[model samples]
Target: MDPVLIMADDDSDHKIERRRGPSTSTLSFSGIIAVAGLLASGVATYNAVQNDIASLKRGELYQERTNERLSEELKSVRIEQRETMKEFNEKLDRIIDQWARGRKQ
Candidate 1:
């Protein structure tokens, strides 16, 4: 082989080796951070769901209690109204009887 040609071949073969540079470390670090973030997000979502369920249960219990209280109040009011109506009717009957007696006389 010609000397010049061989030297040219050696130079071409000795070309600078390719390096990963900072990309390798950056990718590894980014991957680890991304995985950690995903885990954290999952945990947060789970907690939020649990909290929502608990809150709903509490609200439901409160609503049931409120409904029961309102129902009791409505029942008492109805009973009072019935008693008042009975008394009014009795008074009206007495007045009507007296009026009828006066008319007859």
Candidate 2:
């Protein structure tokens, strides 16, 4: 097909010319390669994002397990502390009773 051109004339003997606009048939092989490359880049980016999300999920699961273990350890320590305190108080009471008896005699 013959491409159309626009011509403009001014009164002072000056002229302007414009070429026809490009159509889909005018797209070159390089343009097609560029489009394909863009699509591939998008796919690569999406895969990277998915991998990042999976890694974060694994890290979150590990953290949850660690927290549970720490909580159990803390409970055990508290129970042990309570038992130690009870034994100390009993020993103090017995010593006080012995001192009182000695003073009476």
Lowest lDDT sum, 10 consecutive residues, model 1, at 12-21
lDDT on C-alpha atoms for all candidate structures: 0.95, 0.86
User: How many collisions per candidate?
Assistant: 0, 0
Encode model 2's per-residue lDDT on 61-82: one tens digit a residue: 9999999999999999999999
**Clash pairs, model 2 backbone:** none
Per-model TM-score on C-alpha atoms: 0.75, 0.67
Best by TM-score: 1
As for model 2, its CA RMSD to the true structure in angstroms is: 7.5
Best by lDDT: 1
Off by over 4 Å in 2: 1-26
TM-score of 2: 0.67
